[model samples]
Target: MQKKVPQIVFDSKKPENSGIEILTIESLASRKTEIIDHNPEKAHQVAFHMIVFYTQGESKQLVDFVWHPVKKNTIIHLSKGQINAFQFTKKLKGYILLFTETYLKNQINNSPKNEYLRLFNTHLFSPSIQVPQDSNIIRYFDLFYEEYNNHTEDLNQQNTYKSIYSIIFSKLEGLKQFQPFHLKQSKQVNIFLDFKALLELHFKASRNADFYAEKLNITYKHLNTVCKATVSITAKQFIDQFIVLEAKRLLINSDIKSTELAYSLGFEESTNFVKYFKKHTGFTPNNFKKNYL
Candidate 1:
């Protein structure tokens, strides 16, 4: 028999890297223990823009449904509401900068929209770039650390914060190099983006193809074709996947009994939820938690 993979839940409270709080930043730095067996039980939802800048470490970033490696100097940009995870390496060295999206928005509205956020979002899975230790990049970060250290000071507080956001954006744009995935979007891609947004919000309650088709104002056949063209999964499958993920989350993360879990998940009865879970996963809820939890 093949050895089963271990699915571990990373406790966020312990051994956290500090730079900025989830949606707020003022120059943060820390080293983390390896996160190999750990999986964050919930998606990190925040209004801030997060930049995980690693120096001498590696991490696997789970973005959407794909995992991407992040090595030194190359930053991973996670926009607000994007579901992502940080699986840290054993030897981790880096500063994680978490600033409100508003900070970047203010600068972009005044200046050119920063190219770094744009490029990074497009090429999220590409290989990392190593920044030279003695380079100006390191020197620039030193200044960031200094400013962050002085954040509590009253003098020039507003100006200092403004400058920080501007400097970071400028540095990211200066790294101009990007991968092929950074191409401008096509019409179909835009439509798919909208579809994904809808699915994220309504997947639990809307399980039928016609439900989404009516909302998108398209025929069911057209909706299925669009979903298949982009994601290769039918709309119903996408809905089921979302529901299943939620089921797994509730099962593993909560202390609630299975009967309650079923009802809360919108099942008409506890038995129905148990049956649905068994059909999809080949095991009952208790078995899943026993083996995987």
Candidate 2:
């Protein structure tokens, strides 16, 4: 195994790709090795956001360690820092939309309040969205695909790319509301998002719910309330779940030892870390790695 999951970066300097890479799944298969140094069929972390819209055929995409079955009109979202693996087949057909973080931020800068948060909240929603065949999203994708293919200009030099991105995003935002357990725009959602931001930044420093609650300037009970409201779990459980998810990612993506992994995750004692891992996931770190990896 590698030291860590391979990080695939966007090549904006390529005029053909620019800040955005729009290509068919067939085209992606040909360029897979150029984008990822490791096996594209294996789980790898992406540095940019990716969306794959299947126009035909069927396949399963592993997103953040979950295998989601996808078919025609299915939109698979792979957010930044998320681990995704592809199961390629000659019969599958799709458009893989990839964009740089800078481009994404620029487009979302003008979005209404909490719109940006709702766009990529993979922590709350599943990574896949099924678009009904009759939906206008198909029309939007067709237009974008048609325009993108005929234009040889750098997308960074054109405003059409940005506008199309926002359009597709807004359309997907509407479809996302239909997903089970999808959170609506609310104060609790905002609180949960803020708490999640802090948790990501300081997860290694401390997994204590109170630490994040204090950082977010919200009481522990309030933080717990928001977490339960948003994710059906208490704040502490959410922190544990986050740690376990990270631990699982590291366990599968790397060959780091149990003791080393424990300290790296802020655990002072390896034994305690082992116990904690088993308590939350029902498997010790080594057992999880052995069973899953």
Worst 10 residues of 2 by lDDT: 149-158
Compose the digit string of candidate 1's lDDT tens values, residues 39-112: 34223333455666676666666654357776766566665544456665567566655655555566667666
The C-alpha local distance difference test score for the whole of candidate 2 amounts to 0.81
On a 0 to 1 TM-score scale, where does candidate 1 land against the true structure? 0.60
Q: 43-76, model 2: which lDDT tens digit per residue?
A: 7888899988988888899998789998888999
Give the clashing pairs for model 1. 19-28
The segments of candidate 1 whose C-alpha lies over 4 angstroms from its true place after superposition are 1-49, 59-68, 74-90, 99-143, 151-183, 278-283
Kindly report which residue stretches of model 2 are placed more than 4 angstroms away from their true locations once superposed. 1-4, 16-18, 30-36, 151-157, 290-293
